[model samples]
Target: MPPKGKQATKGQKQIQEENQSTLKFYMYIIFGINAAYLVLQYIFFYDSFTALYIILFLWAVGVNFGSYKFMSSMASKGIDLNMEAGMAEHAKDVILVTCIVQSISLISNYFWLLWLLVPGRAFYLLWVNILAPWIFAEAPEVDEKKQKKMERKMRRH
Candidate 1:
């Protein structure tokens, strides 16, 4: 390492701070919404396992969002080490959401599946709408190049 650079510029620092704050704001909104939903589930469903699952979902959401928010905040303050952990939490959140939905659908006698069709469509939504695109950020670009390379190599071979 050549003594490291001078780090982020002022504008970059400001943008980073803004991003962190926004992330935290989003996290708070998510946490509050989940919390309220849990409360309502308890009130309406009266402590059933569904309500319990809802509560667990809320906790998982909070952990995931809060972890990312905290990581962004740390990065704004010039700490980059925690960002990986935050990303891991976000990935975990995605998996947890799908797992919870699938498990609940199965355990609830396929009632939620009726909301979809057949069963386990929630996994499709979670994976396609969220995880697949997000997890492989470089997949699209890599795929185009890979296809071209494969075509050229096949022609040569």
Candidate 2:
């Protein structure tokens, strides 16, 4: 027979795995939507060849570097590094933020002052480079036991 605590641990592990799978599914869905948007960008803004690639490259670099910094800081703080989650979250944020800033500026429709929009992309890139990793890099870890305990606690409420 398993130890009393061990049984709870096993149960907890199963629940944790289920939760992770569900979360991953959602993350993939979001990623797919973002990817589709990227393709749509090409179709709609066919004239913006250089801008699209530049934006993508900037986003990727921002995410990677941001994640690296986050992981490093976590290590320094004695935190477990969930680099995959960090990267995924950072990628999503960079894309989301970039699109929002770009779209909003465009919708303002001030063609006479088109140059004002040029800095929007640059601003996002700079902001992410400086802040993204620091913002999303070091999240709390969810071990099976902690996850189950949280679930049980949450269900109580």
Candidate 3:
């Protein structure tokens, strides 16, 4: 059998790879939806420059910048984007901004039917923003003292 240290390293690498693949899959879906929304906006609403269009465009730009900031903050913190907790937190922050902008854009454009598009995207965000990250979070390493304290607390409850 391999040394314990080697085995642990191997397991960590496998977890990293799995996390990376999952992140890539979700990113593709998110970007794809964004692209589709942009194209639809252009096709259906492109016309003489209007204040509403300008506002929507500005909001889109803000959302893009916000996403960049989110990624940069994670990098600055030395947080791996593939790590579940960090990824989920970032996703939640970005998704809230995205949802707000999308709602405003839909209302301004009077695309009532476009509201139908929201639930699926919201569901996707909810899953990645909460469920996936929680599931993938590493179990906290507990010292003997902490374990004893936790056991005592459990018994008291």
Candidate 4:
């Protein structure tokens, strides 16, 4: 690493920018492919579940995106949120797998059951995100007397 007084070299900055740009391009491509699959689902099978699948696809993407933003913000604050981030990533994987399985379920039985997990995960993420503020709340400070009284009460118990 460079000394504290020195900024990153121009070459390092350029490399970092190029890497981020490449990563962003790849991410967009993957998302586009998923969207294309949903479009094909609509074209080939125009039914009630078709729209539901589309909505769920968008919802899953939104949840994952929100999780990414949340983790980035937490990291900026010097906090680690690895578990929450992992769940978000796992939820995305589960949804994608469910989509693929549901598509193939047309020929076979039982694959539709996997679709249940998508909404379940969505609800789980919704509940957790809604409660995120309280999850990180700091405890109120107690004056010395109150702290001693609480400690005494704990000992008495």
Worst 10 residues of 2 by lDDT: 103-112
Worst 10 residues of 4 by lDDT: 75-84
| Clash totals for all candidate models | 0, 0, 0, 0
105-156: candidate 3 lDDT, tens digit per residue: 6446654335445466668879998989999999989899999999999999
The most accurate candidate by TM-score is: 3
Error of 3 at 72 (Å): 6.6
Candidate 1 structure quality by residue, lDDT tens digits, 24-89:
565565556566655655576565646556655655565556555565555656653224445434
TM-score of each: 0.37, 0.32, 0.41, 0.36
Runs in model 1 lying further than 4 Å from the true structure: 1-10, 47-55, 58-62, 77-157
What overall lDDT goes with each candidate model?
0.55, 0.51, 0.60, 0.56
lDDT of 2 at 31: 54
Ranking by lDDT: 3, 4, 1, 2
Error of 4 at 143 (Å): 31
Model 4 C-alpha lDDT versus the unseen true structure: 0.56
- Model 4 residue 68 CA deviation in Å: 4.1
